[model samples]
Target: MENLERMEGQCLCGKVTVTAGRRDAVEACHCGMCRQWGGGPYLAVHCDSDVQFVGLENITVYNSSDWAERGFCSECGTHLFYKLKGAEEYAIPAGLFQSGSDFSMTSQIFIDRKPGYYSFANITPEMTEGEVFARYTP
Candidate 1:
């Protein structure tokens, strides 16, 4: 559809530029790799399917697993987005987006696998691996 929110961002060296559309939902992930890659929890925003990706070919994708892929800038090492095979959508890290955008976090995935050091004060829905597999598995 039409662009919902005009958001722009770049990698550390400004080599990778991304423009997302209609991103309003965010999710904070405390998974081990997410923490290691970002030095903290990863904040992802669910952008519209029509997002205009520029310089995306420059971004290298890592197949985190058979079902998931993580995108990052090869030069600056800026983690960008995560995509799950057959999941019908992509997840862009909220921190990678331009600041001052209007967005709110919705859900926290892999809650049971989240690191133990951090505790969430807000009452958000949590999902375990079994729950995710149960819901997504055919």
Candidate 2:
């Protein structure tokens, strides 16, 4: 079960505000697209449908795939969230949130896509790209 607590966050320039309910744990995605987008594994907080946004004008959404889109703060080019095309599955950068929540790294997706140049010390559960696509397909 997920906690019902609300977590608030904003972009670097304070142009975009995000609010989401408590997530179980933060996770990382190391797919090529994710790494290319953020320069490293994308540390994201999965907020299924409990997410809200303020300062809509400051946000820009890019359809990164046929079934997903990536959002960013136009003012500061801050990566805000990645969302499924027709659903409310939102994965936002964990760093955007204020420090206080008890966040833990519980898993990593696109494990095979992860480069061998670096690795996390945490012994988290990992999934390959095929597994992720099967689970997240619309």
Candidate 3:
């Protein structure tokens, strides 16, 4: 994580700023809830607990699931992050970052739920919905 450089980002309106000090490879989530939330699979970067938010007044968090919540800019409605309710981990949209972040698509979750209309060329690991839940079970 020390090698992963810090990155800076902001929403479309510049009312919300995201700064992350640690992050792992990017990931794509193909769950129906993700599609419904963003009109497509969520291409996200895993920042774990290292993301910092500036201008939080413009950020609104919605509890999308029992254990998860999603964040967006209240002023511009730019999708921010999907976070675990019990932890500080965050999955923020990869596009939101303005800096050239050092991340690669290394995994895709809910592979079985991915629609047939499109596909990613990355030869990354894939996990089905059940596999995802099993790994994250509490």
CA lDDT of each prediction against the hidden true structure: 0.76, 0.91, 0.89
Q: How high is the lDDT of residue 52 in model 3?
A: 89
TM-score sort, best first: 2, 3, 1
Candidate 2 weakest ten by summed lDDT: 95-104
TM-score of 3: 0.93
Per-model TM-score, in order, reads: 0.83, 0.94, 0.93
Question: Which parts of model 1 have CA positions greater than 4 angstroms off?
Answer: 1-3, 86-88
lDDT, candidate 2, at 108: 97
lDDT-best of 2 and 3: 2
| Stretches of model 2 off by over 4 angstroms after superposition | none
Pairs that collide, model 2 = none
For 1-138, candidate 3 gives per-residue lDDT tens digits of: 345677888999999999997455689999999999999999998885878899999999999989899999999999999998989888889988765455678899999999999999999999999999999988
| lDDT, residue 105, candidate 1 | 65
lDDT of 1: 0.76
lDDT of 2 by residue, 10-99 (tens): 999998999998876899999999999999999999997869999999999999998889999999999999988888789999999885
Better of 1 and 2 by lDDT: 2
Candidate 1 per-residue lDDT, tens place, 65-118, comes to: 788888899888888788887674777888777673666666787787786778
lDDT: which candidate is best? Answer: 2
Candidate 1 residue 90 Cα shift, in angstroms, is 1.3
